[model samples]
Target: MLQLYGNPRSRAMRCLWMLEEVGRPYQLVEKTTHADDLQTAEYLRLNPNARIPTLVDGDLVLWESMAINLYLAQRYDGPMHCAGPEVLGLAAQWSFWAVLEIEHLLLNFLEHRALLAEFARDPSVTERNELLLKKPLGVLNDALAVRGYLAGNSFTVADLNVAGILMWGKMARMDLSAYPELTRWLDACLARPAYVRLRDQARRK
Candidate 1:
């Protein structure tokens, strides 16, 4: 069985969400971000970077959340694989876009608000992040305006990947007043039973 290592609250949630969407059974192994735990030799051996959401399937070991999801979809599942070019062109498109444009901007704000709270709280950085966010949000608003999902017309791994990162902004209480379309799209995505279950499960863990 595939053994997933990481807390659900972390990027591991993406993997968890994918597994649920694929309807595959896997084992969940919890890890912590605590300094001591991260520094342990055993954990370091599993993930040299000490990051969470590492996966061990047979003798294969991998980290990086999105990559794991892509691998699973490609190897274990079919069109569900967000990485496949032919089956889910848009899936791959939005996945790449989400990581590059959306996640990059979101993380800028998150890092400022989280790891670098003092620096993030700086008016200059906050202002910059706030400004950067509008561009991507606008793009998303326009894309979702005529379409219910990010790829095709139905839910795909692309939607989950993009929406998963966007939910961070929502949790941070980021301003959404100007992006009504984006807000509406996000609401609709989160309304999915899979997403709701993932959110509830993450909260519990």
Candidate 2:
């Protein structure tokens, strides 16, 4: 059986959701971030970065949440599986775009607005990144305005990966009313059964 190391609340949630979508049987190894479990030599062998998420399948070990999801989608027979090279390329494109163009901005805004202690929180940082996020959000909104999904007609890894990062924006309580299309798309993505199951599992703690 495949073993995935990470807590459901972490980026591992994305992999968990993908696994659920693929209807695969796997074990969640439950390594919480900043915990000693991730620092051990055994765990380091699987993921040198000491990250929460590391997947082990036989001799193949993979880290990075997005990469893991993309692999699962392509390797498995499921709704998220890429149909062809073009679909796979678009999936990778949106996944990378989400990480590079949007993830850091959302992270900074979330850290300042919610994750940080009151004394440590910086409204300036939150404000600046929130402004920065507008451009990409608008771009996404425009893209969604023409298509229901990012890559193809149906929901795919591209949607999953991008939505996974954008979820942090929702956590930050960023006003998204102006981007109706993006808001609708995100709402639909989060409402999927797989994502719902992931959230339910995350709430168990």
TM-score of each predicted structure versus truth = 0.83, 0.97
Against the true structure, whose lDDT is highest?
2
Q: Which ten residues in a row have the lowest lDDT in candidate 2?
A: 29-38
- Local distance difference test scores for all models: 0.77, 0.88
lDDT tens digits by residue: candidate 1, 115-186: 564733655665687898888888888888887777666667777788889888887667887888778878
* TM-score, prediction 1: 0.83
Model 1 worst lDDT window (10 residues): 78-87
The candidate that achieves the highest TM-score relative to the unseen native structure: 2
Q: Count of backbone clashes for each model? A: 0, 0
Global CA lDDT of candidate 1, please?
0.77
